[model samples]
Target: MAKHYPPLPISIWRHPAHILAFGFGSGLSPKAPGTVGTLAAVPFVWLAMQYSLMPYLIILLVASLVGIYVCDKTARDLRVHDHPGIVWDEFVGYGITLIAAPDTSYALLLAFFWFRLFDIAKPWPIRVLDAKVHGGWGIMLDDIVAGMFAWVAVQLSYLLWQLF
Candidate 1:
């Protein structure tokens, strides 16, 4: 029974496990947890932009590697694959999307919506990849693809805005 429930603390935000398990408290949101998790990534994205592209990519790569183990472990503990509470993949995915956009409220909101749409819809290659992949990579890859699409969309939007 305990394994079935996501481990919670008296003060969920203060719990280290909760922060890790819930993707920095994003899962605690009353609305769609995944969306919340993606939204929560904006601040990190802002901070990451301070560095060069190479460093950002390195950080993402490291997160991907670590996310595999950490996500898998957390999922196993909760006895579910891609549990809502285990939102690290969403965080990473959104980070990837925001990497391509400038730091602005409009860009952030656009990236968020686009990423969420692709993620929830699981269109095309995204669906195929999600089905074929397994473990943490599986958990993260679909979102990665979604983030790619989101990035592309943001770029297009910027281009269109400039043209008009």
Candidate 2:
């Protein structure tokens, strides 16, 4: 079972693990840290886009894998199961959400909103996976699912727009 954790202290930021786990400081936002982290990730999408699809996908995979370690170590250090301030998952999730998405302002905006909604709402399997799973995968999978859900909505909207 996950132990209850108090809000993180300023001192926590000094550690390298915490720094990465906190979305490189975006997670430090006084409010809606996850949303902030996801938004902060938007600019980075272009960096991944510099590569072709396969390379971008590989980058996502590697980042996600690294996120598991970052999240796990940070949680263990804090003695918390999954801290709200640990928003590296949000960054990675948003990256996954925008993969293969059309590089349009509208698409990016829609993806940002959709990913935030699904991440916050935690619908269906997202909520289920969050609870049933444990450890780092547990923490990351929920956001990944949320990203997929958001990605689907964005893709469908693009397709529907083309038809109309």
Off by over 4 Å in 2: 1-5
Give the per-residue lDDT digits (tens) of candidate 1, residues 97-158.
87757768888888888889888888999989877887678877888888888788888888
Model 2 lDDT, full chain set: 0.83
Candidate with maximal lDDT: 2
The Cα local distance difference test for each model comes to 0.75, 0.83
> For model 1, where is the 10-residue window of minimal lDDT?
1-10
Residues 102-158 of candidate 2 have per-residue lDDT tens digits of: 777787798898899999889999999988986678878899899999889888888
| After superposition, candidate 1 runs with Cα above 4 Å error | 1-18
If scored against the real structure, what TM-score would every candidate get? 0.83, 0.91
The 10 consecutive residues of candidate 2 with the worst lDDT sum are 1-10
